[model samples]
Target: MAHDTGSSLTRIFAPAKPPAGAKAGTVGEAADAKPPVVVSLSASAPAAPAPAGAPAAKSFAEVTTDARAALDANLARMKESGRTLGMGANQGSQADIDAAFQGMDRRSLHAIASNSGGLFSKDEQAFAQTVMSQQLVEATGMDDPAGFQRDPARGFLAGVRFLDTVSAEEKASDNWRLNRAVAQTNYESSMTRDHPGEKAENVDSGDPVVNFLAQTIRSKEGTWTSVHDGSYVDDLSRITLFKDGTDASGLQKARQGAGTATRDAAARIDITL
Candidate 1:
């Protein structure tokens, strides 16, 4: 018998094709024969690209950090130029501070205001308070921007004297109502409760309520006998009007007054009142 070496070798090396009815990828006549498995060792698919012209959004923490850094840089620049904030021999102008504040947004200002760290000086703290207060008025069109008073001596804290009355939640609150309430209460207490030695009339509490009441009463004193007769003692005594708090009788009147004031303030700024 003559051996066909080439054909024999081909038969041995290459697998035999499955019989006619067999499924694809299988070899031989056995019904149980499995196809050879293939696995890829290739790298993973690439991630999809971001949309065109859209920048990555920042987190609250990142925004706050950026705000603080910008504030520091601005202060540093001012210092380098031999100027400083607040009342001093070489005090920086309000324009300088306002320009620096342009880098910050409402959230950034909120974060800065909520901070209790010694990172900011009294004047810086005062500036932040003033700016935030104004922003609140501008944004919410609420009355009593002056309610958010600052001493530039002790900074605008959330409570009476040294005691912080506002909870952490309230301090962190974005709600304008809560902010106004806290500011107003703190201001009121600073005038009446905090200073016991001084007469309410003589004390310049930086409180808008007291100021408004006092000014209104004094201006009306010339016309209204009730104020001139000293029955209420002084214009500051009009704060008693708010003494009722949220009583049923007072609530509506209070709301009406607040609404009117808010509208007036917003009107002066030429915004929605």
Candidate 2:
């Protein structure tokens, strides 16, 4: 499938004002001061109507098989690129990795990286972590609701770290970074439904899933620009995808090609066996 490069959105998160009695410039204060701004990256292409005599949607088993194949192929490519699939920094043993993989669904695998605390020792493992984390968070809420509320920033920072550590090569080819972002956005969207009347406005985007993806793409592009422009130092310490409100800067549109490619590949799987 041809990749689309121009389909990205841009969003800006303006700094928030400090709460009353809080010291100016404290981390919490600064975070509280930022307001999120979301702009549409691109209008979503309308879903095409099924063609006459188009094959039925693949069964869940077929879909799962196809996903596994894509994952295996991607993993092989990563291995060829000198990436290692070994234990992460904090993982105790190969058994740990194996156990983690056992009985886990693709989404769970996708969500692993984000929840792994950034302890991966190799790029391939990091990629795996993202895939696993994406899956896991979507299946499960972003941790317990109370815990998430207590420190939502932690989850957001972990996501940023995953994106930041993605190899440029992987980002360009596998599009894992974009996929991870999309997955996280989807998770956040689900979280909004799970909790009512709690900073609902703060997290509001026309569509949380799409907006979250758009915001992530913008944040990544901004980081790259800031690094090269010499106007601001690149810092990943306080990464935030949501602020006063969320905004998009057109990155999501550019990355949609990758997402489409993934879906198409899975949809084409032959499950006659």
Candidate 3:
């Protein structure tokens, strides 16, 4: 008789099939007869977003791919314009070009995208009022040290600084008391400590002093009187108001009459006797 394959020996030559509820194969039998496994894996990892204010980081391969595409478009346009062009019809290896762009830096990319593409002609110093550094240079017409030269972004920043400086100067010089009621009282009390000297100098500047002095006179902080038949004025008024004048008995009495207060200067009188 012919020898049977394992399947024929086990299944066909053996007893009839077992009931569906019964166990089929032993654990070891199933383990040894396991099928080959087929695993499927994706080609690349998922992307991660960069955080705010952070520049996005990219691999050399990714960057090179973008740079090559952009340079290709540029070459095409130059050829169409018939101004002369180069670069092969085939796309560049993104790896090499991306390496170059990454090495160049952010500003270089900006320059290439901007100036090479004839961008910013309308956006910058295209007019007189432009705050471009070149415009500032033209307006100020300064020369020599290149620092005085204009650039759009820097000129704008400098002009803002200039305006801030001017505003500070005006605040110092004008002394425009923004809170006048509070400032006025503080100033008045300080100035009237003395008058007609350095203390007065602190208060009266043109109209302020004149107005202050007039105010002092009305407030009687400044006073005028007749003493020893002399006219005496005191802001730090006179030290003494009355002095003994000789009467018939030769007794001295303070009179409502003029006293010796005027000893520092001339005396005044009106005689009705």
Position 208, candidate 1: lDDT? 37
> Which pairs clash in the backbone of model 1?
none
Rank the candidate models, highest TM-score first: 1, 2, 3
**Who wins the TM-score comparison?**
1
- Please report how far candidate 1 places residue 252 from its true position, in Å: 23
lDDT of 3 by residue, 95-205 (tens): 222222333322223233223234322211011011111111222112112432232223223322222222111211111111111123223433343222433223222
**Candidate 2 residues 39-68, lDDT tens each?**
111112222557999998654445445445
TM-score of each: 0.33, 0.24, 0.17
Residue range 2-118, candidate 1, lDDT tens digits: 222122211221122212232222112112332211111111212235689878756666666776887888777867887555433223444555655665655555456455344
Give the poorly placed runs of model 3, Cα more than 4 Å off: 1-56, 85-145, 148-273
**lDDT on C-alpha atoms for all candidate structures:** 0.37, 0.34, 0.25
Q: Tell me which of candidates 2 and 3 scores higher on TM-score.
A: 2
**Candidate 2, poorest ten consecutive residues by summed lDDT:** 6-15
Scored against the true structure, residue 31 in model 2 reaches a CA lDDT of 30
Model 3: per-residue Cα lDDT at residue 167: 18
